[model samples]
Target: MIQGPCFQILLLLGVVAVAAADRRPSFSYSAPRASSEESGPAQYNFNWAVNDDSSENDFGHQETRDNDNTKGSYSVQLPDGRLQTVTYYVDGDSGYIADVKYVGEARYPDSDEVRSYTPPRRQYN
Candidate 1:
C-alpha cells in the first residue's frame, strides 16, 4: 500500500482530476433578429365597464391606440354623488394630456344623520 507523502500527493492529484472532469465549457449565444412583420406598428382598441348597484361600484374605461398615438377616457361615480371623468391622449413623442370634468354637485350627510348610525351586531359561530 502507498504511504506518507506519496499517498497524499496521489490523493490530491486524483481529486483534482475528478474536479477538472466535472467542469463544463462556457458558451456564447446571439439572439435572432426580428422579422419585418414582427416589427410592425401596434394597433388596438378596448373598453370595459363595471356597474354594481349593490356594492355601489360604477366605473368604466376605453382606449384606442394606433402606432405611437393613443386616446382614452375613464370615469367613476364618486361617493358624494358626482361622476368624475377624465379624457386623455398621447401623440407620438408628445407627453400624456388629460381633461377632467364632474357631472353633479357633491353632497354630504348632515351631522344628525351621521350621529344616528349604529354598528351591526356580531353572532358567534
Candidate 2:
C-alpha cells in the first residue's frame, strides 16, 4: 500500500524471478546411445572432385588424381577467416611441378621447381 524505491526494486525483481524459475533445470530429449564395441572405424577415406561450374562469382575448383599424382586446386574465401588456395601438383615420374605452398608465407624461387618442364635445381648455391 506504500512502496517506492522503484516499488521495492520491482518487488525484489519479482521475487528473484520466481525463485530463479523454481530452480530451473529440466530437459529431456534423449536419442543418442550407440554401441557395438563403441562403433568405431569410419572417419573419412578420400575422394575429390568439384569442378562443375562453381558460383558465387566463380571461384571454387577442386581436383584429385592418383596414379602417382596429379592434383589441382583453387579455393577462395578470405573475408578474414583465412583460406585462399591455388594448389597444383604433377609429379608423375619426376615431372614435379609444384604449388600448394605456404612455405613461410609465400616466396617462390629455386625457379619454382619444375621437372619435365625444366628447372629441377639447375643451379642454386
Candidate 3:
C-alpha cells in the first residue's frame, strides 16, 4: 500500500547496503591436501601478503602480542600451506622478509601438500 518515490529510493538504499555488507572479503586461507602415503613434511606454498594487502583479521592475531598496532607485521603462507603472520623490521631503507612462522592453518592452496622434495647434497668447497 506504500507506493511512492521515497519508498523506492529507501528500498534501493537498503538493497545496496545489504549487498555491501555481504561482500566481505576473506583473509583466511585454504589448507593444502596431503597424502599419508608420502613421507616427510609436505610442501605447501604460503600465501604471503604484504602489509598493504592484509585485512582487518591480521590486526587481531594472537601473535601480535595483543598489540594490534604493530607496524612491521604482515600475513603470509607457510610451506605447510598454513596461513601465517610474519613480522619484519626495517633494515636501512628497504623492507625485507624477516622472521616467518606459522600463525595458523590456511583454508586454500594451489596445490596439495602430498609431495615434498629435497635438494641434492653437495660437498662444501
Candidates sorted by lDDT, best first: 1, 2, 3
**Top TM-score hit:** 1
lDDT computed for candidate 2: 0.56
Query: Could you give the C-alpha RMSD of every candidate to the true structure, in order shown?
Result: 5.6, 16.4, 24.2
The window of 10 residues in a row where model 2 has the poorest summed lDDT is: 50-59
List TM-scores for all candidates, in order: 0.69, 0.24, 0.22
Candidate 3, residues 29-63: lDDT per residue as tens digits?
A: 78887876857533232333333232222222222
- In candidate 2, what are the lDDT values of residues 45-119, reduced to their tens digit? 244444322322224666666556667777654433344667777765777565653222433335444332342
On TM-score, who's better, 1 or 3?
1
Local distance difference test, per candidate?
A: 0.91, 0.56, 0.52
- The predicted structure with the larger lDDT, 1 or 2, is 1
Off by over 4 Å in 3: 1-71, 76-81, 93-97, 105-125
